[model samples]
Target: MNLYSIAIQQLTRQHMATIEALVRQQPEFDRVEDLADRLRQAGVRAEARYVPAEKLFIAVYGDIAQVEAALETLCRLNRLNCVPGSSSWQLVHQDHSITQPAVLVIHL
Candidate 1:
């Protein structure tokens, strides 16, 4: 299975809460989950999880492209405040495996 890690900074409780709420809302995550499920159905065994911290919320997904797309969509929808490749976040993909694509979003 391919793995992609997406990290978003939580500059404030409000931003963190917003991100947490969005994660719980199934519809908000539908496209991403669907993409992961599709990969799993194809024998990829995809999964996604969120790691919360005092100043960050990291979302680990199965596909880098899909996760990137989803985050970009969120930005477009005004759900998020930054772009995928903006200075606010740093994205790194694993060279040997899909297990470690790190995406960091710095909260403004």
Candidate 2:
């Protein structure tokens, strides 16, 4: 796990036992952060989170071409395995467990 994950866990375990943030399943967050990391490595600005939803989404603010490329990369890396969705951001999967979700805040 990354420092981000560890830190989040510690904070929640110590400070947020109740409902303070949206938690996700382990594999779900894993894939999300992994996708963010891969995108960063590819020089694409992106992240994964749910502002107030039930699933994670890769929030991107780059050129359309770059975003498309990043999405393609995610698919190739087996990250974006989202089923055919009826939402704005199709999720890789939906697991609403209470665990720290990987939220990559890529500061522009």
Candidate 3:
């Protein structure tokens, strides 16, 4: 009975978590699309986007273990030499900052 209860508790607490990392790359770097495609092929839903000179957000949403595994694969494939947990997210845009919708905002 004790073992069964423990197992149930563990199962109940299982939930999905998201892991994000800013892909800091230079103008010459152009592997965003390829990386996103590879991650999708590996069964991980990843979004690799470049918001201009700002940050390249790479977000993976899945189970904790799966996310960790995907993150590892991402690092291995991308050759990210930075330490883990070293990067943090920063808000590049705010709702009040821009009055126009993103579709209307055009960049040169």
Candidate 4:
């Protein structure tokens, strides 16, 4: 498997619970989830939820070229006017560091 696939595999099993917990804490994330579901209906296995420390993480598996398309669709569905920063990983383990994709991280 490639790096992206490996990263996603690790996250799906280990990080999804934390993500779900964080999502439950935010009302805005409910809308995000709804938008994610729509993306799923369109054949994108996209997952959107919050990681710890209040940062949102979106993971898209399959077709790297389609990743941005998924994100754009998400932005349109949520009516977000700006493109958030993209990141390669989900969670970061650092002290006093905002190194883990602070501005709406999207991964593929």
Candidate 5:
């Protein structure tokens, strides 16, 4: 498997308990600051949130290319497994859980 696939497989084993803890404490607000900072530096209007269901959601309004690049950088640095979609990027986390769906939506 390629490096990307390897990373995806690795996260599939992440314990859901950690995700649940994040949702309760809302620590993802601090955790995603780097991503938000990168988007803002690229002149994009962005916000990052951790849903109560243990999902990570990042919304960006700006040039599509810039938004995509920023997200790419974030994923690379954070070792996140993200698959690009038509209107958003599906961030694959643990596959064993239904509540940890991480998604990044781009707005023009």
Candidate 6:
């Protein structure tokens, strides 16, 4: 099987639905909408959620590499930093003074 098929099988074996990412900043409503739109445009199924007083949560469905590349492009354009993990992504501010929160990727 190809990589995508293998990935799907692995996720299925683990009973995982989606891979999630965390953005350290709580962005404005417009920014959140823009993020979701951009991901969709890149052909990745994605959703961004921002609850009041909580960090921004991004859930991506499909190829992880594609999602990460899309995220990196978006972050570069927005002057943010994109850090990717095995099954999660983290978006941080470019400015080093701002500390990034600890990231946890929960598989469900």
Which candidate number has the best lDDT?
5
Question: Scored by CA lDDT, what does every candidate get?
Answer: 0.44, 0.56, 0.46, 0.57, 0.66, 0.63
Write down the TM-score for model 4: 0.46
Mind giving the per-residue lDDT tens digits that candidate 4 earns over 18-94? 66775565765664566567668767787886655755655667875566666566556544433444444222223
Candidate closer to the true structure by TM-score (higher is better), 1 or 5 = 5
For model 4, the run of ten residues with the poorest summed lDDT: 89-98
lDDT of 1 by residue, 5-34 (tens): 222233466688877886766553454454
Extract clashing residue pairs from model 5: none
**Rank order by TM-score, top first?**
6, 5, 2, 4, 3, 1
lDDT for predicted candidate 2 compared with the true structure = 0.56
Which candidate ranks first by TM-score, i.e. highest?
6
TM-score of each: 0.29, 0.48, 0.41, 0.46, 0.52, 0.53
- Residues 1-108 of candidate 6: C-alpha lDDT, one tens digit per residue: 799999989988665432222332334444656667787888878776655465556667887677777887888886777776778766667888865543322111
**Which candidate, 5 or 6, would have the higher TM-score against the true structure?**
6
Clashing residue pairs found in predicted model 1: none
Query: Residue-wise lDDT of candidate 3 within 46-99, one digit each (tens)?
Result: 666656465355555565456556556665665443234423222122344543
How displaced is residue 40 in candidate 4, in Å? 1.1
What local lDDT score does residue 107 receive in model 5, on the 0 to 100 scale? 58
- Candidate 2 local lDDT, 4-86, one digit each (tens): 99998998796664343435255666767777778778887777665544455566666656655665666566533333322
Question: 9-46 in candidate 5: lDDT tens per residue?
Answer: 77865656676766675544665655667668767788
Ranking by lDDT: 5, 6, 4, 2, 3, 1
